[model samples]
Target: MKVGFVSLGCCKNLVDSEQIMGVLRENGHEIVGDPRQADAIVINTCGFIQPAKEESINTIFEMSQYASKLIVTGCLAQRYEETLRSEIPEIDAVIPIRDYGELAEKLQEVLKDAGNGSFSKSERALSGNPWSAYVKISDGCSNRCTYCAIPLIRGNQTSKLLSEVREEIEALAEHGVQEVTLIAQDTTKYGLDNYGRLMLADLIREVDRIEGIRWIRILYMYPDEITEEVLQAMKESSKVLPYFDIPMQHASNRLLKLMNRRGTKEDVLALVSRIREMFPEATLRTTAIVGFPTETEEEFQELLDFVKEVRWDRFGAFTYSREEDTPAWSMSPEVDEQTAQRRLDQLMQVQEQISLESNQKKIGQVVEVLVEEREALTGRYRGRSRADAPDEADGQVIFTSPREIEPGTFVNVRIDEARPYDVAGVLAE
Candidate 1:
């Protein structure tokens, strides 16, 4: 059987998709890039926000048209299994995230007619950039933010064993992976449930010792949990990049309390200040939500002011989504759709200016870029620096090279031009 897989949502979900792909390969099924060429299709979906849910549904319908067997899994399937089974009779199977332990057996039942084959010992069949991959150190969220449905969907945080994480990275390193980004719902809180204490710093140090892994980055760190130990470990590590991806949903103290976030506005300010003082060359990235329940104009202004004060190197914003069963869903005086959209626009506009100014300052600086691809027509190479992640949120570096360069090669480029979200440069002489 040739199986086509569609992975949606964040990097965390992508890791699951890759693991599932590994299962399929181990079971003797061929993986196809196109849905039309598949005997079955698997959609690993996102149900985090309204927009994401819509995309997941749309993709299900789209993929359904291509394959005879349509299997739906991931957050959407986990959250609304019954609804999907009842409403979408076209779906052949609906497997939730919790049931992944039996994924091999379940998939075997679905694809019984397909022949078996041998596969790599690694549990993940990596997709996208072969040289760079995301390694999930943990799954789910313990932080019960009022507005977030993650706790409801994923249950409590379960940190992967330290040895397990190290083994995965070592396998990736052996396979020629140069950059590995450590990801979780809250990376700073890793090992709390399993080891009874935060062990992100230890994990980083362990990864630093791994051979062939040139760059290590950590993402989705809750601001309040970032400790001195973690910071120092990153500072001392030869491989770990100085990239912080802290998602401070809002800046208003009142809003923060309502959202059930741990840090206050002043706390975040001090955290950002301390980080800058510690690593002047560090890249700070953040995300924010606008139009939460009872969000007043003054509160929105406070968030704007916070963004200006922080001047995040890379920023992303989303309007509030009212998901059922969450505390915020029933909160009084919800922000209207128009108001939410307007606030989102205003927030992004401010961020655009900040981003442009931030990128502009990088002009004339020489930076190491992990080459990703070269434009076919223009023949210009495009890649990312330590400042950028593999996600679309970050900027890319485009440069001209006199010589042909392979995709996974890292080279230095001197910045020549800057845009709001991207920088262009020439290969350093």
Candidate 2:
């Protein structure tokens, strides 16, 4: 049977989608790219907030047109099993996330003629660019932030044992993966539930030992948990890129406290200073949430001022989503949708200038780029530098060369031009 899989939301959820496809393939199902050609279609969804949940629902309905059997899994299924089953009459099955291990059995029950075959549990049949992959170090979130429903959705942090992670990395390395992005709900809190202390620094040290892995990137690190030890580990390792992806959320200490985030405004400032002092060349990326409950004009100004002063190399912004069951859901003085969106827009405008400055500085500098693709028409090679993560949400370097280079090969590109989110140049000797 041809099964087309639709992966939605964050990279973490994408990993789950990969595993589902892997199990299905092992159970004698053909994985097809086009939904129209599928006997069944499975959607691995994201129910993180309003926007993501809407996307998941829309995707399910869209696939229903093509698939004879429509299966919904991941966060949306886990969160709204009853609602989806009742409202969406076309949905054949709604497989909850917790029962992912039993995916093969579930499919066999619904896809009768598709046959009965057990999951091999060997390895994931990865999707997307073969040259890049995301290695999820842990599952779930321990930090119960006031406005977040992650703890309610994914439960507590469960760190994969160091040996297990290393084993997975080994498999990925053998699969021709050149770059791996370490991801989790709270990556810095990894091993706290199991090892009783932060093990991210040591984990990097271990993963860096893998032979075929060229670039190692880490993301979703909680602020106030990015230890000096982690920095030291990154600095010492040749493979570990000095790229910090710290999601501070907001700049006002008062707003942060209300949001139930760790660290004060001064603490964040100090941490950023320390990081820049230690690794000046490091690519610092961050994400923020604007228009939290009761956020004053002064507070919004504070955030804008901080962004201008700090000048983050890469930045992303999202408006606060008033999710149900969260502490802030019923909180007073909720910022209206229009106001929240305006704040997000204003914040990003500031970031655009900062990004332009950061990229302009890269002009005339030679950086190592992991070749990702070659444009058949333009004959230009495109790839990522240390600043870019495997997620592709970040920037890339598009360079031209007389010699032929493979997708996974690393080449030095001398940057001569810059864009807000990309750079261009010629391949170096």
Q: Which one is best on lDDT?
A: 1
Off by over 4 Å in 1: 113-122
Candidate 1 has a TM-score of 0.98
lDDT of each: 0.91, 0.87
Give per-residue CA lDDT, model 2, range 1-429, as digits (tens). 899999999999988888888878777789999988999998999999999999998998889999889989999898889999999999999998777667777877887645343333447888988878898899889897998888887889999999989988888889888888899998998899999999998898999899899888899888789998988888889888888898889889998999889998788788889988988888888888988899988999999999998788888889999899999999988899899999999988888888888899999999999998999999999998888886646888999999999888889999999898899999999
Cα lDDT tens digits, model 1, 272-388, are 899999899999999999999999999999999999999999899999999999999899899999999999999999999998898899999999999999999999999999999
Clashing pairs in 2: none
406, model 1: CA deviation in Å?
0.7
